[model samples]
Target: MPEVGVTYFAGTFVRHPLTMAVVHAALRHMRANPGLQEQVNTTAERLVDRLHALLAAEGFPMHIGRFGSLLKPEWTQEPAFGELFYYYLREAGVYAWDARPNYLTTAHGDTELDRIVEGFEYAVGQMKRGGFLDDVRPTAQLVTLASDRTSITVPSTESQREVWLADRFVAGNSLAYNEGLLLTLDGALDEDALRHALQTLLDRHESLRARFSRDGRRLVIDHHLELDLPVHDLSGLGEAERTAALERLCDEEMGRTFDLRRGPLIRFALARLDERRHRLLFIAHHAVCDGWSGAVLLTELGAVYSARVTGRAAELDPAPRYADYVAVERHFLESPVGQAHREYWLKQLHDAPQPPQLPPDRSPGPDPGLSAARVDVPVDAELVTRLRALGSAHGASLVATMLTGFAELFRRCTGQDDLVIGLAAAGQSFHGQGQLVGHCVNLLPLRLRLDTADGFADALAITRTALLDAYDHQGVSFGTLLPELELTPRRQSAAAGERRVQHRRARRRHRPRRSGCRLPHAGAAGRDLRVVHQRGRHRHVDGAGGQLPHRAVQRGAHPRLPGGLPRPAARRLRR
Candidate 1:
């Protein structure tokens, strides 16, 4: 026999409408009218009787159980929340502590039914004398069906279309564009306030309340109510233990795949390590957000969190809904500027030189897995200064020098003088794109034609020119570039929602969405190394080397070659 205080339910709390109605209605009606004990009981009984009839008519088992007698244990689905509270009746509380039955499920038996009615009757009498009967109205939000919870549908932005198509081509792999961030905050944190701040963001940004799904062959997104933010308490653990556990948690959450098909797409966690320290992590699929958007989220979240703790409302700028981006994206894709940019990319990559091939630790059978190992090659302060000096002399910045160095690295690896690398540029140069949280990155191909006789200085010069030229046509989504260059990603496997890209040899270079690193493609038949510069650090994730060494540096012969240094210093570094 089940424990005496156990509660049971007949169906899922969410799927069973009648059970939900009975529970909610009982609580609401009882709270609103403590004087009408007899009427409340009558109403509850009538509701249960009608529910039983409806359930029985639907061929479900709904026989009444004997008082305090055990029946078959297969009729309920319990530990109903209501029953747990049924026993929470204080002498002056409205809830029927000893008499309320838990939720109804298929596993519930006779004793449960008797308890439900008894609990309701006793609770009504007690509540009439106390807590819930007090005249403060319940905080029920008044929302119109047509206003607050509006669902807006729109076509996916070109960037979304790009990743969605790539995801489809990966057979069963869902790693096309998922990205994450983990920030450790020093000082105290209030979880309740944190949750509220996050909720504020969700309310302010439509994309946060969005889901992506296919409407037949066309890709679309539907915006709905904001997702509930999740927080965890690990403040009880030791400082040392909690820090380790926090890292593991961050990894697990970041690596965890998102279901873009039915998405909140964004995942968040605030691990409370101690009263003075906390770690906050945010993970989102690239389709809903880009690198720039991630920073925007953090800045806004910080602003909101601070304002909340101090009792001030956050004055975030009016959020531009994701739908607006979709409309704007569509307009640009058909505009003259878009056409002009498209022409530039097409011309730039038309005869794109094959990327330099590097012998991988293993054969890259296919280029679709996200399993990666991080390789960090350190550059001391001296090297950084020299690189900056070189960049200044050449009228190029450190990023340009890095790009130039990478071009030289490729040439050496494959004995090829001409090579192409991918670079990610912010797509915010356009008006109205300054604050939206969605995919808005420009992936531009930096093609370099070199000669073996060219010195490091000459290589930087070529790279600097290419970088400047790239600025002219850096607005188009890289996904759009693929089709334009006849380099659509091939499907390793096919299923519903997969775009039919003709299996053709890749004619242009490809880059990962957020990681600006030039990706190795099937056209080369050999792996090409990629370099990702993030947060002032250059980390290489082994692509084909799906299993990157824990601390291996898959770098070129020159350790300082990893990052591009600026101009006259470029000459000094060459030494």
Candidate 2:
């Protein structure tokens, strides 16, 4: 049986005393409409029942009951809450409840209460003015799975809280910005032309105006808007100062959250660097954009900027909008394409091993609790020249050569003949659509199993083949693959009998560093060597207590060139 508990608010749920009066006034008006009252009653009942079931199934120690503005709670005696909670989640929209034990008795001072009432009144007014509830739903796509046992459980209250907080934080911090290398031109560019180009880009991408709201606890997106991209002038600051300002603007833009009661969740900022050089920063929440989307924006902006600078009309074609991609994705997921991919994954991972057994740590927190350390294996200029020569000799790209080096690194690190590392591919393959911004990238996990005697050239051949295969099958989304692979979370069993399968399953494989991992890139200009350090932290579940490997190393001169390599200065000047 599920436990039951009460939820308390710091004060009356209505916020201000006047707000309660307004609410009472609204309620009296609402009472005159029998149909509206009926709908509200039904919604409330459904919500309560769903909450109860969620608590019971998740084995939440408490159940919530509302009396007037106060919620009553009860504690659970059952052990397995995850199964039931997830079941409730799928059946209904409830993801979480306020878990703070003393919620009801908390005191909200007068100032806070006033703000809450004002917000409520504003929200109610909007709702009455044909503001649909769907407009306020969150825009999170539901990640589905195939096997029942594949569901990963949020093991504790803390874990659940962390997920909630992470979602909220991510939503709150999204911006209309694209992460790209900003280049400052030495000459003035046409601002009006630039604005026109930007507006065209915004109109072309549906993600630029995607709105988010909550569908129960899950986030749902409604792509709506024909928005104009705002442009500003910042051509009067030093280069360093301009970069600093752009970075700050990016941070600020990414940190905004949408309020349903407020008008729109869009923001833009521009910074000036000097008389001729200027920087443009665009930010949008992940609710509307992804990494691949950023690439598309940069590619388009480059083209548009170039066109304007050259005084040539932009020669870009009218490509499909992001909504088209979503429609195509939905169709693909439901059609033969999705099925074939699912079958492929099913066979590949049919006898796959369990997740890697990471080393344990003692951390008492709700953060992903994962950390990472990176090392750059810099190839000498000569070696780079040699590698380029070798690639040209073998008809391979620089990317292929890099893959070979990575495979070698993994082979040495894991001591395994067969290795696989997931690579994120920029999804810009759509014809006449490389520049359209949206979440078009997918992480393709490539397997590289090299024979111990294999040379770099042989490994490169295999890497090339694997990458091509991934590109061929890039139509399927990871959201669809997770389910068919039966990669759901498993419960930690206390009984010894349950340990056998778990231990056996655990020994079978290795996983990569957590998501958002990036490699450091080094570049050289004139007499100075510039190394760009990309910092990334891993996201782990709460109570997992996992520590990623960390190391600190000193920077040193570039290794000696392999052979016949031009000096760094000549190379820079040539570029």
Candidate 3:
């Protein structure tokens, strides 16, 4: 088996002297500290053993040099550059580590070059102050081998500078730390008032004020902001322009790294567009917030803003800090609750079908990136009412109805009775007090199998059952479940399979509709009944028969039935 050892200086793995020097230096450093010396020695010894094991397992030569200084002809053999880029991002708090060559090129235009230079200077200043690098640990992994057989040099570019800044500031903070927020508001509002409200909301939430940093490889948080936040106006721009700007800003911000040795590790931006509308973007390295934090920020911001605008004192009670949630989560993970949840997921998804096979790209290249198109299905008041009535009749929630509808569509498309699709669940369920802005959002994979012979109501019930089962086991992170489920992509071949099986499962599950609407009934009953349905878009399909017959079916009382099944119909609607 190949050996594993760390090298302080740049060299080939064959040079054992260089590697041994590094190991000796590390040992001396460890010995200097009575407590850490023991810990470091133990860790280093174990890591070396693991490295040897890894080499034996992969049958690949093992080399441990500064990652940035390593070079091999085969490095360009595959898309290894991308993989290495991500590896550096994880290990060294840097991004685009493989883009050294591209970064060397500078803008020819004097003005553009000047701007780039300014940005680079700002980035360098930030780096020095540990501005972006405040909470991040330093690593020797930033070194990169030259593209040609030449000495490695740090290349410069505006994009690279921004990325470097963000990576220095943000990445690897914490898995459950805060993710930024995207807020959209109605077009009639006061920008200053909104900003004030947001500030107040931030002040109220301990997580918003939390400070984070890296204590070596470990993340630590202090629940308070190091700097005051400033809100800016971002109104009167086109959607594309706004999107582009936000993307750029996000990219720049995400690239920054913070010095953990410093006090605070958080930043906020409020972009307003006119008096009535705006977006508030809060970018915190994960060490500070998560999905739950985003929702908490939104809810609290809304409430605090509303209160300030209306001249009412906010009455929110004191809630526990994010550290509390961490404690709770840790406890739950170790407790019976986590084990039970895991067991439930194991049972529920044991035989689940894979995710749908997305349509092949028509793009010209063989890029591995994804392209997506969305079709919006509007549920007007009347349609919403009808769907709600149907769901009510079956004692199902609106989400249950939609899930059933989607299940039918899936059956038609994949021709598989057993199917699994992902669902998003908001993780708030009567947890402790305080403004709960953290990663509370979770993805849940729901499995539904349709017995072809079953009626629509039966199918709906099955969907409802599955949804409820998912809800019951929703505490586990979808992030965790995804890997556990080992969901393979739906195969094109399986799309033609047909299983004529019938099974009846019983239960009451509450699947709430995404939205509810109240519409006046046209019948003599004269009831103003509320209808609930999945909020966003719904698919419309031509009935199973010909165009004219399909139109007739839509016009007829059974408009929803014909579109519920059949491959051609589902495909047409999906398209």
Give the alpha-carbon lDDT of every model.
0.53, 0.41, 0.43
Q: Give the 10-residue window scoring lowest on summed lDDT in candidate 1.
A: 499-508
Candidate order (TM-score): 1, 2, 3
lDDT string for model 2 (100-177, tens) is: 222211133444334433443343233335333322332211111111101111111111122233344432211112
Q: Which sections of candidate 2 miss by over 4 Å?
A: 1-183, 216-247, 250-267, 290-296, 299-313, 353-382, 389-397, 426-435, 451-458, 486-575
Superposition TM-score, candidate 2 onto the true structure: 0.50
Error of 3 at 214 (Å): 6.9
Tens-place lDDT per residue, model 3, 1-575, is 23765434444556655576787876787577657634433443333333334323332221221112122111111221223323433343323333232121111334533443343333334333543333333322112222121111111212112222333443232211223444556567666677677666555555454432221222223222334556664556787887677555554554444432242446666556557655555566443454345545555666777788789887776755555665565566568987898778877776666444322223224322111111223456556556767888888986677667656654664456787565555444534433565444444657677765378888888888888888877777644544565444442122111111111111111112221211111111100111122343333321110112222222223334422422223122221
Candidate 1 C-alpha error for residue 523, in Å: 25
lDDT against true structure, model 1: 0.53
Ranking by lDDT: 1, 3, 2
Candidate 1 vs candidate 3: the TM-score winner is: 1
| The best candidate in terms of lDDT | 1
| TM-score for all models, in order of appearance | 0.63, 0.50, 0.48
